[model samples]
Target: MEDGMGFWNLRNFNLAMLAKQGWRMIQGNDSLLYKCFKGRYFPRSSFLDAKESLGCSYVWRSLLAALPILRSGYCWRVGNGSSISVLGDKWIPNHPTNKVLHPINELADEMAVSELIDSKLHVWRSGTIMSLFHKEDADAITKIPLSRRVVPDSIS
Candidate 1:
């Protein structure tokens, strides 16, 4: 819908509005809308992972429809890292896609970032990082400093 002249597109605006609702569902766990949706739609998983069902309503379908737009920017801020998958979750910094550049190998897809961190010291295990991931990914992973205090994983 682009033209030589710079102007706002109503379609994009509408899409953005829909994506905002999806974002609110992610950030506002205490809201009634989120609570209702959680009970009916995504009881066991995150909003980003929610799936379509045969009997879902139009409004619910609309929110889920905007998920691709929401997921493109969604990323995990590492903490315990136990809940995040090394290859599946978006946690890496600097990469354009906000994902790890290296491809999964030998069940590495099932590995957690915690596996590359030393629990006692709360520091990244450099040797393990270098051994498991590509140089770029290893460097990016190391660049992200770990918290001294133990914290739960959260969305970023």
Candidate 2:
């Protein structure tokens, strides 16, 4: 029974190590896995799309095997709103649609949520919100708190 418990602990530890390494590879662009794929480690849309390729090293294959687990816990935490795309990013919460509620074609593809903020007052620009989003979307956007201090955007 003691031996069995020891084995179970070891198995859990191994799984945890693999998960950490997989997350590191996914987050670090300089990782060998990214280099192996010519700077593309995993798809941003979903890591489940990652697959074993011909002539790939054993380490790369191991990383690929752990992607599903990594993807399960992945989430976006909005910060300064500089890096997140208003139209393409999954920033809004509890909405049926992950993307922005309404997309304006005239807006640049790189338009960030920061653009909709009033820099002076540190709040959402009411005019911009009204112009870009519907009433419900504007309400949702307003509910999201913006940081007064500058910070980098991150994913977890």
Candidate 3:
């Protein structure tokens, strides 16, 4: 029992040290575990997309197990809205669902919220809003406060 407690304490201390340095201590470009955790949500084309790759280290497998929990807590914060997909991103607030209902017109897959804003006026383009969003959705979108200066979108 005493040996187990000592091991547990040492493990926690190591984790705390890693946390303190923002996990920068574990830096190795070739490390499978590092690759898995660093871009778990958006993996590079060369990296393995599978949750459990064959012959993966125990650490890599453990990171895969934690991916779902990490993803569940992530939420989008609309800023300039350039990065978010108009129909695909979950930027809308206070709706039954965060995504916009079926867009009236078939917008490009990469269409962004910023495209709906009038560049000169720095406000939502009424015509575009009316065309893209349902009445209720348009009304809900209008309530979101737009900053005078454009900023980059963020994930929280």
User: After superposing candidate 1, which stretches have Cα over 4 Å from the reference?
Assistant: 1-9
Ranking by lDDT: 1, 2, 3
Q: Which stretches of candidate 3 lie above 4 Å from their native place?
A: 1-61, 70-73
Cα distance off (Å), candidate 1, residue 91: 0.5
Native-referenced Cα lDDT, model 1: 0.85
Name every residue pair that clashes in candidate 2: none
Cα lDDT tens digits for candidate 2, 46-145: 3435677677677777666666676556645567777678876677776666457766677788799889877777777878887778788778778777
- lDDT tens per residue, model 3, 35-134: 5555653354211223565676665555445444434434456777776778866677776667786666677877888898776666878787877778
RMSD over all Cα atoms, model 2: 5.6
Q: What local lDDT score does residue 142 receive in model 3, on the 0 to 100 scale?
A: 78
CA RMSD, predictions in order: 2.5, 5.6, 7.3
Candidate 1 per-residue lDDT over residues 1-156, each given as its tens digit: 455687778777877899999999987799999999999999998899999999999999988878999898888888978878888889886776667887747646678878878999999999988877789888898998789999987777
Candidate 2 residue runs with Cα over 4 Å from true position: 1-20, 24-56, 65-73
In model 1, what lDDT does residue 41 have? 92
